[model samples]
Target: EDQVTQSPEALRLQEGESSSLNCSYTVSGLRGLFWYRQDPGKGPEFLFTLYSAGEEKEKERLKATLTKKESFLHITAPKPEDSATYLCAVQAVRVQGAQKLVFGQGTRLTINP
Candidate 1:
C-alpha cells in the first residue's frame, strides 16, 4: 500500500530558528508530490508541486525538495507567523483513469518570539 509518514510530529522553535520537516512516502506510479501549509480551523494552502525527483521549489523562507522516496520541507529563519501544520500529499496514477491523494499526518511547528 502507498502511504506517507511525517516525523517529529510537532516542533517548537524560537523565532528565527531554522528546521527541516520530513515526509516519507512509498507509492506505485507516482504522478506528483504536493506540499501544503494549514492554519488552525482553515483548509490547507498549496505550497509546492513536485513532478519528479531532483525537483525543488521555494517560497520566501520555505523550500521544498523531492527525491525518489521522500520529500523535505526546509524552513529557514522562521518567524511566529510561520507557525502552522505542514502537510505532504502524494498523487498516484490509478488504473481507472483517476488519481488519489495520500496525505501525511503533518508536522505542527510553533515559532515563539
Candidate 2:
C-alpha cells in the first residue's frame, strides 16, 4: 500500500523564522513526488516535482529535496505571506491503466509578524 505522512500537523513561526517540513512516503513502483501550497479556501498551487532520490527543486524562499523514503520542504526567512498548508503527494505506476495520487494530510504552517 502506498502512503504518505506529514509531521507536525501544525506549526507556528515568527516572521523571518526558518524551518523545514517533512513528508514521508512508501510506495511500490514510484513514479514521482510532488509538493504544493494551498491557501485558505483555495486549491493547491504546484511547487515542485521530484522523480528520484537526491533530486531537489527550489522557488523563492522554499526548497524541496527528495530521498528514497521521504521529502523535505525547507523554508528560509519565511514571511506572513508564506503561511499556508503545504501538501505532499506521490504518483505510482499505473495499475490497470488508472493512475493514483496519494496525498499526505499536510502541514499547516502559520507565520506571524
Candidate 3:
C-alpha cells in the first residue's frame, strides 16, 4: 500500500517569513520522491528528486529534504511571486510499469507584502 498526504491546505505568509511544507507517506517499498511547483493553470515544474532517506536538493529560496517516512519542503525569504501550489509527486519503481506517478493534494501558499 502507498499513500501520501500534505498538511496546511493553505498557508499565508509575510514576504520574508520562513516556513516548512510537510508530506507524509507510506509505501510497500521506497522508490523515489519528487517535488514540483505548479501555478494556477499550468503543468507542474519539477523541483527536486530524492532517491534516499538522507538526501536533499535546493534551488533559490526553496529546499527539499527527504527521510524514510516523510519529506519537507522549506521556503526561505519568499516573495509575492513565489505564491503558488506546491505539489509532491512520488513514484515506486517497485511497481514496475503499473503507474508512473502519484500526486499529493498540494499546499497552496500565499506571500503577502
Candidate 4:
C-alpha cells in the first residue's frame, strides 16, 4: 500500500531554534515528493518538489530532501513567521500518467518568540 506518515505530530521551538521533520512513505513507484506549508484555517502553500534520490530543494529557512523510502524537511534557524504545519505529499506513477497527491498528516510546528 502507498502511504505517507510524518513523525513528531507537533513541535514547539523557541525563535531561532532549528529542527527537522520526517516524512516516511511507502509507494509502489514514486513519481515525485512534495512539501508544503499550511497555516491554520488556510490551504497549503507549495514549498518544494523533489524527484529522485539525493535531490534537495530549499526556500529561506526550509530545506527538503528525498530518499528512496522517505523524505525530510529541515528547518534551519526558524523564526516565528516560519511556524506552520509542514505537509508531505507523494505522487505515484500511474498507468494513465495522471498523478494525484497522497498527503500525510502534517507536522504542526510552533515557533515562539
Point to the candidate with the largest lDDT: 2
lDDT string, candidate 3, 44-109, tens digits:
999898989989898999999999999999999999999999988678766356756688899999
Clashes per model (N, Cα, C within 3 A): 0, 0, 0, 0
C-alpha TM-score for every candidate: 0.96, 0.96, 0.94, 0.96
lDDT by candidate, in order shown: 0.94, 0.95, 0.89, 0.92
List CA RMSD, all candidates: 0.9, 1.0, 1.2, 0.9
Please provide the root mean square deviation of candidate 4 (C-alpha atoms, Å): 0.9
Q: Lowest summed lDDT over 10 consecutive residues: which window, candidate 4?
A: 91-100
Model 3 weakest lDDT span, ten residues long: 92-101
- Show where candidate 3 strays beyond 4 Å: none
The TM-score of candidate 4 is 0.96
Give the C-alpha lDDT of model 2.
Answer: 0.95
Per-residue lDDT of 1-113 in model 2, one digit per residue for the tens? 99999988999999999999999999997899999999999999999999999999999999999999999999999999999999999999876767778999999999999
2 or 4, greater by lDDT: 2
